[model samples]
Target: MSTMGNSTNIFWQESPIGKLERQKLLNQKGCVVWITGLSGSGKSTLACSLSRELYTRGKLSYILDGDNLRHGLNKDLGFKADDRTENIRRVGEVAKLFADTGLICIASLISPYRKDRDACRAMLPDANFIEARLLEDGLHEHVRQEIQKAFTSLHVLERLKIFSPYLDLISLHSRSYIQPGFTGIDDPYEPPLNCEIEIQQKDGDCPTPGAMAGEVVSYLEEKGWDVYQQASGSNM
Candidate 1:
């Protein structure tokens, strides 16, 4: 029996099937690879690339993208601090369940708060929760892209013309276009201090998505997560 938060009279339920049994059936150890970074930092791209790579290698993996989840599972949640905390908490629990089922779960999100991320990490076993932090050294490139995107839209271009007098001011501030409450801009984005993996751009040049995925795959192999004996007629 257990009680949590506002709920009472709750009891823990144990499944007859164990995690080891599921791991044997799937022929791979379960774990969660949490990819976190600022917006436009290629977190989603890496998640997709990693998933495809794992699929080709006969490993099962699932992706829980933050924006995609907002369409349904977290539709009602806002961008407020408390709501963001709840969002991460819910996703962490779901990822924990997926890991228990012997599937690799990749969660890509701009989980800016270190405390929130640490709380999620606490929900899983020490080694099972792998935090992959993406340090984007291409801030100028990102700003350029944002400018190009704005100019490509006629409406945005008109707005820019109306504010052309402030163009010099905007040019002086690299992050002037960033709105209030934006993570890494206005709001704080506390980076992970002890993450297991760190992916970064080199010399202002971001590696190809495939190459980044390969790095993560190599890590998994080195950690023995990529090694599994094949079972006859197994299709996972």
Candidate 2:
């Protein structure tokens, strides 16, 4: 049991068509790869790349990007601590639905707070949802990409320096009144201690987001949830 929903006096309506039935039809077991980190952490890149890789391997996957959601479903929400928690909660519900229906739902968001991220984790059963943390070192390619796409020809080093103090403060505290919901500013972003798969793009590893995506796919395969396994008539 991952979590208990908020509603009371309401019962869950079990679907006549279960997850196994859907998975067998789709040739894949559903799961949510919740990618959590700060902005410019390469979550968007990872999500898209992973989705494409899975698709190429004859698997069904979808990316639910944070910015894309804000333009529609979460548009009404502001950047307050409570609003941020609610945002993740809503995304978790959607991801749960996607996972139940045999789809790999990749949720990329700057889910700053540890509690919020944990709540999302609780929404799915063990192994169904994985927390993928993208650390600063893994974002070297992200820095390069963002710089190239910058409208003002901003320097990457300068930007990192600007954001460093805030992150340092966040490392010391869980919440701050000044930055409100901004992680590493006024809000804290608790790094995952034991994530299922930690893709490190460090000094000696594959440096591209695509490579990290492949690593995630490989990790999933090792966990006995390979999407391709279904096609071979093997049970996960």
Q: Give one clash count per candidate, in the order shown.
A: 0, 0
Candidate 1 per-residue lDDT, tens place, 52-111, comes to 888877788999998899998999998889999999988998999999999999999999
lDDT of 2 by residue, 1-236 (tens): 32456756566678889999998888888999999876666788899899988887778898888879999889999888788888888998899999999999999998887888788889899889898988756445565344334412223434656456765564334323223344654356788878877766567564597887987888899888865443445533
Off by over 4 Å in 2: 1-9, 138-181, 204-206, 228-236
RMSD of each: 5.6, 8.9
Badly placed stretches (over 4 Å) of model 1 are: 139-179, 227-236
Worst 10 residues of 1 by lDDT: 227-236
As for candidate 2, its clashing pairs are none
Write out the backbone clash pairs for model 1. none
Q: Which candidate is the best by TM-score?
A: 1
Give the range of the ten consecutive residues with the poorest summed lDDT in model 2: 171-180
Query: In model 1, what lDDT does residue 86 have?
Result: 90
Clashes of 1: 0
Whole-model lDDT, candidate 2?
0.77
